[model samples]
Target: MNERELQQLTEHISQQFFGKAFRHQAVFNDRLKTTGGRYLLGTHNIELNRRYLEEHGREELIGIIKHELCHYHLHLEGKGYQHRDRDFKSLLKQVGAPRFCTPLKTVQNKRRAEKRHEYICTGCGRSFIRKRRFDTSRYVCGVCKGKLKWLRTTDSL
Candidate 1:
């Protein structure tokens, strides 16, 4: 749906679920990455990722709106609006809103998993897997305190 429809839907959900009117703007933000939607702390406006609606459908969009509304209402009331807060969690449960939105397939596909670097201790013959490479001369093995040698680098599964 367009921004107008989104604004109307957000207002409806806020009133229907929280028994409060949403006076701020709700717009589809194309710049949003990874997140399905975000509640702006400054303006109290809700910015949603349009790609989420396109990829996940209407129900997902509704859930995202509900999630954002939870933040909107809680923050306005001066309660705990962050995800870790008790108020936010309870409100999310009460409204039947999702804790986290499902990741978009396209976004998931674009992210590359971190590669692991394999190393072996020359003296102890012990294998080590690290996220980043370290200098063999500076660092020694914990077991035998021996020099380390680079073995192989593999993509993390």
Candidate 2:
């Protein structure tokens, strides 16, 4: 569906489930690579992953909408809107919204194959692993405070 359709559907779901009208926007965001949907706290908009609909169909899409709506309504009403809040949990159960968005399998697999940069202390021959590359000039080995050299980077998977 298009943006207009998405907005209409979100509004409909909000009224039907939450007894409130959704005043903010609802749009499909292709940049959402992992989560099925997101509730934007700043703009109070709802962003959905179109790929989720293609993969899981209309029922899943409705569930995602409901999940996002839970965030939307509670946030606007000054209640607990975050996932961990008791108010949020109760609202989710009341509306039958999923507690967590389903993670995309492709994103999960890619995350599992994460690589890390390896570093070794030249003086003590101690090893260190970091998820990101860091400047060797500014940092030293934690164990011996010696000069560090770049070692072979490796993937964890």
Candidate 3:
């Protein structure tokens, strides 16, 4: 859907679920990487990740809209709109909105597949973990002036 459809959907959802009319703009935002949606406190606009609708369908999109609406209504009313606030939590439960958005599958995989390169000092036998491979010949152990040798690489979440 386009920006106009998004705005209309947000307004409809606001009225249906929150008993309020949304007076701010709602648009699909391609730049949103990890978040499903966000309510801008300054502009009172709601930015939704387009990938969410394509991947999770309209149900998930509606949930995200509700979540953002919770923030919008609370902030506009000068009530606590943060996740930790009782007002926010109460509205979320009342509206059936998710407390947190699910992380994008690709993003989660990239984070879980982190690699660590291990090296050991020849003289002191000290072990070090580095994120990237290094030139062992050019670098020495921080202590004992020992030559560093590649040990093993590990991958972990």
Q: Pick the candidate with the highest lDDT.
A: 1
Q: Candidate 1, which ten residues in sequence have the lowest lDDT sum?
A: 105-114
22-93, model 1: which lDDT tens digit per residue? 999999989888999999999999999999889989999999999999999899999999999999999999
Judged by lDDT against the true structure, how good is candidate 3? Answer: 0.93
Local distance difference test, per candidate?
0.94, 0.90, 0.93
Query: RMSDs, each prediction?
Result: 2.2, 3.2, 2.6
- Score candidate 2 by lDDT: 0.90
Q: Residue 40, candidate 1: how far off, in angstroms?
A: 1.9
Q: Could you give candidate 3's per-residue lDDT for residues 1-157 as a string of tens digits?
A: 9898888999999999999899989998899889999999899999999988988889999999999999999999999999999999999999999998776776666675779999999999999999999999999999999999999999966
Winner by TM-score between candidate 3 and candidate 1? 3
Cα misplacement distance, residue 89 of candidate 3 (Å): 0.5
* Models sorted by TM-score, best on top: 3, 1, 2
List the pairs of residues colliding in candidate 1: none
